[model samples]
Target: MFTSRERSLGKLVVERFRKRRAERINNLMVKEGAYWYDNFITRTSLLEGLSLLIPGLKFGEDVNDFRDLGNSNYRALLRALDKLDDHELQFFKTFINSHFYVCHATNNPAIATKKDMVLFSRRKLIEQDIKFNTYNTAYVDIAGLANDDNVFFSLEIGARPQKTIPGAGGSRFGNTYYKVAYTDPSFDFSSLYLFDQALMDIPQCKISDISEEAKAILNSRKYTRKSICFYGRKSLPALALSIISATRLLPERDRLVLLGCRTEKEKKRTAALSF
Candidate 1:
């Protein structure tokens, strides 16, 4: 049997695979401006959390822009990385290597479909991780099951939660109603922002020294929905767009997901290029 430390590494390996693959898909979707990208997470059963403390952070052009979302998220990533302290980072390396880091079958000589692999197996690994951590600083509650049936998960995507940007009020007027209520092993869905503030953009960029056309283009943009109900009947393309877009940036190899381009042709043309 694997040691406790070894098992944590194993989970990271599995989570990382999906993340890497998702990044590839995100880049393609971004380039294509595909309508389906945002809806994936917004409409599906996927779960995500928001940091309540985010509203208090100061905001300005220096941080909240479309292109800068990645930069903002990078800051969040640094915070999460800092949270690791020295002990966590040292152990994280081993966890990355102890598993099937790569899905050889997807890249094999025969036919392929990554989305198929995700539905068939990849997603099962991520299982409720989206909702695992209800608070900014806390541990996730893993629903332990057998390895093949393993549903345990956590976020290692490395993006920090954006706490500086204002809501720019995603066009709605209401007091926030989401809360964990309580923390435990079982997961619960409630009111929350879909992703981090870094991923969500408040509509204020084009209003600056840009043309009316540019303002229209900026206004056209929207953030992903904060909550998704798989049991429901709505299709949230916008939410999925943000989630998938965010997913597309995961580290490579074991972190690949099924969302990326299924063909080599697609992969080569739209693969994400880190800046």
Candidate 2:
């Protein structure tokens, strides 16, 4: 038999434990959800930006085709780039830096008589940083899931699965499609308009891909008051731009710091972009 005071103390400990567990779970979910949204936005932005630059360029299908075109028409592309105005050139540069890895290699190293020439190379971008900001963020799935027919149906019928009506062949398996009817008061579907608004005010930058050395230099105490770490090699420019845009959604007192790392092994090599 436990005393009343002892029982009360046990109940308080259990409640505290439950509260801490819930907080941890919520934090994990927010982190995962933020990562998913970041990836989706970054990828979609790349595709949309590419489509604007190169017409008829479709994601997944036309990537190889575009690569071939770039390789075959390398000189022609350079000439075309030279013809672009200042604004157009800046946009093109930003697009390339965000979506591709620009590499430089020196050729004719063996020939003592011949001067070495530098060659420019472009490769697909990879290893984007995981996003950390999750507060007051809104993401709408403009491109919905491919196999969400059943999901929409369930939502329509108050989350209860519906039985298929028997056909002449006796309950033949067939695809059932349902148009999404946004009737849930809990979810604000009106926020979808914000996507279009963001597109209208996209910012352009003069430079992209801040060097690792420069990032390390910025990581010093002299440059940064506080820092938030991020991991990636490519897509830092896009991430920076996204962070800048998201600042409007944050409170004035809340500022963002971008710390870039190529790999987890070099996690100590940090950078900061204070705003």
Candidate 3:
């Protein structure tokens, strides 16, 4: 019923709309896949990636570490990593160094107790004349550290609760339950190395170094939904560092929240402290 010119214009509009729709669908799929990879598959992928990067590394003796073999998610992460160019790989390394923490707890009689006891940073270990075995380390994200409520609880109890342990089969290694703990606050802050070089340590801040400005920023309704990236030997110092770093690293619009703690005392301590 339309003129030829009108019909041509209608067809062009339809084509453009279809193209945009397709792009939107594709983007959605990509995002969903990324979410799956990050949440469900990243732990296995990280272990596998470390195995690939390090020639003779073994997670545990007499255990098949790659039990998640044939998993589609596992394969997908490896494929993605394999496709990265040198520059991309370097960027990935930088990202990992910035966002991840290496937890080194052990049951080795020479180094630590029969049950895993949380130790200080590498610098602290050296200062105390303790020898560490790097082969028996676990890599975890900083965000995970901020989210775990039981870190202090496990330390207080001297054993990780059964429910909180990583796998259903119980501790992976013999007599050693790997868990992160809140480090001692009394240690020298100058020597404290919470994370890699990408994250700078606040050399002078103690457990109670939080500023009023930082507290206000966190309490603001605008930032209520933001996830805080904590860094410190103890809770308040961690909170303070996260607030300080967020000003530079995170976007202005994002919120910053603290991780969970076990005790009312710890909570009260954090609440009472201000700089």
TM-score of 1: 0.20
**Pairs with steric clashes in candidate 3:** 226-255
lDDT of 2: 0.27
TM-score-superior candidate, 2 or 3: 3
Model 2 residue 131 CA deviation in Å: 33
Q: Please say which candidate is ahead in lDDT: 1 or 2.
A: 1
Please identify model 1 stretches exceeding 4 Å from their true place: 34-275
lDDT of 1 at 91: 32
Q: Model 2: which ten-residue window has the lowest total lDDT?
A: 145-154
lDDT of 3 by residue, 185-270 (tens): 22211112122211222223223334545445433322111112121223333333333333333233321222222244433333
Cα lDDT of model 1 by residue, 145-227, tens digit: 10122121221111221112236522121222111112211222111123222234443432222345443443355543212
Ranking by TM-score: 3, 1, 2
TM-score: model 2 vs. ground truth: 0.18
**What is the Cα-based lDDT of residue 217 in candidate 3?**
46
What TM-score against the true fold does each predicted structure earn?
0.20, 0.18, 0.22
- 120-172 per-residue lDDT for model 2 (tens digits): 11110112332322221223211111111111111111122233433532212
